[model samples]
Every structure is written in C-alpha cells, then in structure tokens.
Target: MKRWSRAAVVAVSAVAATALVLTGCSGSNKGAGGGSSSPANGDAASTVKQAADVMAKVTGMHVSLTVQGSVPNLAVTKLDGDVSNTPQTVATGTATLVVGKNPVDSKFVFVDGHLYSDVADPGKYADYGNGASIYDVSTLLDPNRGLAKLLSNLQNPKVVGSEQINGIPTTKISGTSSADDITTLAGARLSPKDAQNTPTTVWIASDGSYHLVKIEISPVQNGTVTMTMSDWGKQVTATKPA
Candidate 1:
C-alpha cells in the first residue's frame, strides 16, 4: 500500500462533491434501499425536496466527473468510474492528470475500506488508508445526509432556468451553501480550516423523475467542480485490487 498525502485524502473523502472529484463514487440497491419518491415541480422548494428524495434512493449508478483547480498543486482534468451499493462501499475509476501541456492517465480504486491508486509495479499498490474508502455507500442516497440533502441546505434554491443534460431536459437551480455542508455530503469529518461556504448549482430531471442530473460547486480559492450522474438503477460490482 502506498501512502497518500493527508490533503489528498481529505479532498477525496471530505470535499469530493464540492472541491474534489472522488465523491462521484456512489450507488445503491433498491431492495435494500428506499425507492424513488414522487416528482414535485409545484415550486422550487417542492422540486428540490422531490429531487432530493429521488436521489436518496439510488442503489447504484455510473458517475462521470470533471474537476478544475480543485486540488492544490494537482491539476486533475477528468475522472470517470462506477459506484456500487450491493456489497460494500467501493469506487473504482481512472483519472486524467494535466501536467505542463500534457495529460497523464492513472487508475484509482477504493474497496474493503482501503484505497489503491497509480499502481506501478505489479502487485505493488499505493494504499491511501482504510478510511479512504468511498463515502458511506448506504447513505450515498440518503436524503437526510446525502448529496441531495447537503444541496437542500443551500441558501435560497431558485430555478435559474432549464437545460438539456445528456439529452434529458432538466431544470437548473442555483444557490449558496457552506463548505461544511459539502464536506458532510462526502461522509468525511472535517476541521475548521477546511470550511469555506461556497456557491452551488444543480440540475434536476424535468421529465418528472426529479433525478439529479448535474451539480456544480465553487469554493473561493479552489476552482469550480462539476459532476454528472446517470444510469440510474444500474448495477455495479467492485472487486478488490489484486
């Protein structure tokens, strides 16, 4: 196992949704978890509540992420992976790192309470500690404390407009939220220095499902981060790295 910097660990598990890209790992099983709720477009508040409920019931899905200027000194340009909810919390994906004028590829996997990344020699893995596993899988869709739950805490959610996400028409909403809230969504505890209330934007499916189609969060110093989720109700399986 390779040692990962504490800062990277914090960003991966604590601020991935707002300031990092790792939080994109999440999924669920409908039988073990709750089902989607009714879509509410009666008003902005109702819409958010409905979407939040639908998102909380997600059992498993694919997550595609793009982050800019998030991690200090590390310019990550792209990350895409699968988030599972059947077995245990696990997120496995590949990332594109931009260095100088070139892009580099790397692999990352979190399973069984352990994180492995950038494998170089065969059988040699850099371990990022057991605490580095993906955010609580069961609660990944929990409306009370899940990503949607955190977004609900944003101040004054307003329907900015509507847009098409992956061809699905979606209602766009924007609001302001605290960095603390973002960290809470990632399922990682944080210290005072890591807090930075930030502005956030979310897009919800307008077809009546109220599923979360996209989210954008911007912190003061960190660059803007955007995440797109799809394949709702999809099945995902993660195996421990060999």
Candidate 2:
C-alpha cells in the first residue's frame, strides 16, 4: 500500500509539470502571433514619414490609377503605365478619358514635358503641350508636389492595421490632407467643397523597405481615387513619337 501511494504521487507530479510546460508554450505562441497584426514600432506617423522619404528616391515604378465618380478638373478615368524620374520625369501608358458621357481609350507618352497621344490624332501622336487636355502621369512623381509630399503632409496619421497587397505584407495607415496637396500629388483638381480635409489611406510595405504600395483618397463628391504602385526600380524608357 505504501509503495502504491508513493508511485501515484510521483505520477501526479509529472503530469502537472507537463501541463505547465505546454501552457507556457501556448501563451508564448499567442503573444508572438498577436504581435504580427499590431502596428510596427508603435508609431504610425513616423512610419508614413519614412515611407515618403523612401519613395522620394525611387527611380522608376509601374503605376495604376483609377477614379470612380467625377473629380473636378480631372478628366482621365484610368491610367496604367511605367514612369521613370531618373534624369527626367517621363511616362508611357494607356489612359481612359470621359468625353461627354463617353469613355475614350488612348495610348499616350509623356516626354520632354509634352504629352503625345493617339487620341488627339489617330495614327499620329499629337502634342498636348504638357497634358492640359488630360491628366499628366509624371506629376505623380514630382519630388516636391507629388506623392512624397502628400505623405509628409498627412494630418493625424494612424495605423489602421496590417494586410497583404499583391502577396506583399503591408501596414495600412489613415490620415487627412489639404485638397491642394492631394490635387498636386495626383495632378487633379477638386472643388472648394470637396477639397476640405480629404480623407486618405495609404499602404506601406512592412518588410522594412517602407515602399509606398497603394494610396486612396476621397476628394470628390461621392467619388474616390486610388493609385497602386509596383515594380520598383525597374528600367523605363520613353522617347518622343515620330
């Protein structure tokens, strides 16, 4: 009877120890997983500033712009193309414009501060004189008045959360900016009413690169504008149309 009691006590102690070890490991894992979804470094504004600084130095990238609803002084509804800021700011892409309730698609190239598009004259490129007829893609990369400045001018930026953008992990941030800054960055115009404190959201890569992955802004009445950037540092060449 004494031997049996001693054996039972030893067995109970071993079971309790195993349970404790397992509980500890489970708690540790839970903490680690929770951290992955939290804001990095616990400073959302600083992260945005860092991302802006990084993007200001990008040489070339692929960009996509989409607009839903009407934006004042902006005619292009969609644009997709490669842009390079090295040596000069240039772009080659396709654009969709709304003309009197109809959508017109055209291939265009911006070089030497001139916009050449087949829409202006079919089979031959017509110089639009710096894209006054349509939107200018190069303005999106202007160092002082472009995306970098927009990011730097964010008001009350806060980390929304973390998510994946095209298989790349990113931290989402929300903020507001002046209509003038937003329009300058997008090369668009907004009305006085729609321009007041536009709500903006941006996604920055969380992999320590701090690259600007996406930006969305609501700067029009019942409309939204979104831009996504990818293929960073890719080579882009734009030449004048013959």
Candidate 3:
C-alpha cells in the first residue's frame, strides 16, 4: 500500500479526536424527542437549537462516515466507530484508506486522552501524544463553544423539509457558513484565503430528543464529506493500552 501524506493522516485523525472530544463527560441525559415529522411550530432555527440542546446531552454514540474527495493524496473511503462521552471518552474503530491505487487498512484507538494508530502494512502501533495531537476534540462537542456555536451562527438556515434516515424520522435543514466557522468548531485554524465557503445540511431527529442524525459538508475544492451518527445513549468504554 502507498504511504499517506502527513496532512492526509491528520485530516482523518479528526475523526478520532472529535469522537473523543464531543463525547467527553457529557453524561447520559435522556432527550425529549417526539415522533413528530417536523420541529415545534415547524421553525427551522428553533428546530436546530432544540436539536443542539438534545445532542449536547448524548453520552455515547456510533459514527459512520464516508469522506470522498475531501483530502488530497489520501482517499478515505469509509470509517465507522463507537465513542462514549460520559465519565470519559473512549473510541476504537477501523478505516479504509486508499493511497494512490492501493487500499490500506488502518486501525485507531483513543483512550486516556492518547491516540494510537496501526497500519496493516507496517503492522506496528505508534502513539500520537495528546499534546502534539493535530486535531482538537473539545471544539466539536462543547455545548457552548463548538458545534452549538456553529449552529447558532448559521446564516439563513432553511428548512429542507422532513425525511427519514435509517428508519428514524428527521427534520432536514440547509444552510451556508464560512469554513472558518467550521474550522473553529473542529478546533482547526485556517488561513483566510483557505477558508473557502461551505454548504451544509443537517438532519435532526424528530423523536423529541432533537439529536443530530446526520451532517454533510461540501467544500468547493474537496467535494463532500458525510457523517451519520446514531446509537445515542449506548455505553462505550476504552481501557488504557498495555
């Protein structure tokens, strides 16, 4: 398999970082979800706010992502994993990466605030220290600072109507925002020029919990990145590496 560029690796590393950050100590709080097809009063902004509040209480979840044309030199076709936020955040999962024309298998684990990577070709494990970590997890799940802020700052959010995802009823919303806003939410800083415009769509569960079910980001240069989140309230735990 071909080697992945450092930048590419860091890009995907965001997955693990966010998985741990967003779930950290959130504590299991049951959501006030209803099976309604639309949000209260069918208001998009209110719906987003309500959903944000619901997701902020999630203790653990499962994430599946497909990143196509998002990063250069690395082709991350699919990634899936589980994460827990209560007490401590922990994660483990596999990713399918295509470097050049060859596909490589990569495994990742996050526990005790440390990140570990294993590549099938090398068949060895390397630890990326928490201090040197490239991705910032706290910025994603922080109710006041990260994704909540981004959603609150959404420009002209519009209701795209209701849809069903994975058999779950959801309210879809579409909007546009500066990439800088997202970078901040993800704990990344980009040069002004590099902060291209981004179009986003999000699906919030209508079951009353208003938890986020899916999100999509389309960058002018990188194509589209999609993430689907589910299994809310599931228990997840990670042990320190031996």
State the lDDT of candidate 3 residue by residue for 1-242, as single tens digits: 99999999998999889887767534322232344333434888888887777767777788877766644322456667777756776777777766567777787677777766564345565776641232333344556655556676666778878889999988889987686676654333445664665687889888777888988766546656677888988877766545
Candidate order (lDDT) = 2, 3, 1
Top TM-score hit? 2
| Candidate 1 lDDT tens digits, 17-58 | 664343332233444334543223336777787887777677
Clashes of each: 9, 0, 9
Give a tens-digit lDDT track for model 2, residues 165-205: 99888999999999878877666677787788899999999
TM-score of every candidate relative to the true structure: 0.68, 0.87, 0.71
Question: In candidate 2, which residue ranges exceed 4 Å CA deviation?
Answer: 1-26, 29-31, 34-37
Give the total clashing residue pairs for model 2. Answer: 0
Give the TM-score ranking, best first.
2, 3, 1
Q: List the residue pairs that clash in candidate 1.
A: 1-127, 2-126, 2-127, 27-59, 27-60, 28-59, 28-60, 29-59, 56-141
Position 104, candidate 2: lDDT: 84
